[model samples]
Target: MTTSSSYPDIDAQADLMVYLVLSQLLMRHLTGRWLTVQHVVESTHLWLLTNGGSVDWLQRISLGSRAQELAEEVAQIEGITFDVRTLEAAFSGYQHLNHRSPAVAAIYGACVAFVVERRTAGSRTGSEK
Candidate 1:
């Protein structure tokens, strides 16, 4: 898919949607408290550790599949072709980041920073072409 000012590609859009889904799920589980991205990531890390590190199990218990379906619909409404696998991979990768670092919040924060940097660089390059 074409990159836009808002998203670098469909995969990035899907990743954002998956993040939103997880954030919403965490918010509901915490009784509607406000949450930052770090809070969601850390909570998800703890939850995965407690629940056998199975993304499929999380999906089953938390309506994650349904949320992905909804995200796909939203993408279609926006005229972008959506792949369910992109969301699935993003969700799994987000959870997997916890495994890469002992400092729970740090890894997620770094990952977000890296992605933002890459996207910003890409956009600048594209605009200069």
Candidate 2:
């Protein structure tokens, strides 16, 4: 017997799955995807703070609206700190370039990178408690 059906590319599937997850997460936690990129980024910030910051997976890139205090507490517990200034720069670029199709990808990528950087840094070192 010969194979007929083929499966999708693993990397493409992964990207789609990640996008779906992020889209739903952002929509559910914040407003909807119709909202401006700046609003989306703001929602992410609020969600992170509520979820107990980068030290918690819940706030890593999923359970966004968990609690600012919890985020800070976890970061403190992990002996890590959130870099506001670096993020502020990223956000500025994200917001400024809003309304452009090409920039949309750039904005989301930068924002995701920022969030990942914070979350990964803490957990990567086996410092999370």
Candidate 3:
């Protein structure tokens, strides 16, 4: 009989699971005004530590494509339109930040920047009355 521990990619799978949970929590928090970038980063770090993982492990693993897919799924479930490429870019940017900041903060910053840019562009186009 084969045991679950025998799986070669078990750690990766567990990390992905944790990412999914984090994504859900983030989505819920995004709807409220009290969720700051600092909160997101701190919460993410705490979650990782409690889940038997670390920021180093998260930074080392590449989950860009999977993250994009998960974002799409969450967006659909929440009835929101999300640009998967923007999310992909956020993850890409986080990877290149070189430990300067937490992944959640980097991604949240990118997302906020995107939203602000979109609002600015919309105003310029007179899309918002």
Give the number of the best model, judged by lDDT. Answer: 1
Count clashing residue pairs in model 3. 0
What TM-score should be assigned to candidate 2? Answer: 0.24
TM-score of candidate 1 against the unseen true structure: 0.26
Q: After superposition, how far is residue 65 of candidate 3 from its true place, in Å?
A: 14
Q: How accurate locally, in lDDT, is each candidate?
A: 0.40, 0.35, 0.40
Alpha-carbon lDDT of model 1: 0.40
lDDT for each residue of candidate 1 in 24-57, tens digit (9 for 90 to 100): 4334444544355465555555555644443433
Q: How far is candidate 2 from the true structure (C-alpha RMSD, Å)?
A: 13.8
The positional error of residue 75 in candidate 1, measured at the CA in angstroms, is: 16
For candidate 2, write residues 1-129 as lDDT tens digits.
Answer: 423233212232222222333333334334433334454346555544443342333333332332232233322323222233322332334323222333234334444444455445755786421
Check candidate 2 and list the clashing pairs.
Answer: 47-64, 49-67, 49-68, 50-66, 50-67, 50-68, 51-67, 52-70, 52-71, 53-71
Q: Which window of 10 residues has the lowest lDDT sum in candidate 1?
A: 98-107
- Per-residue error for 98 in candidate 2, Å, reads 9.5
Superposed model 3: Cα runs more than 4 Å off: 1-34, 54-73, 77-129
Candidate 1 wrong stretches, greater than 4 Å: 1-7, 37-129
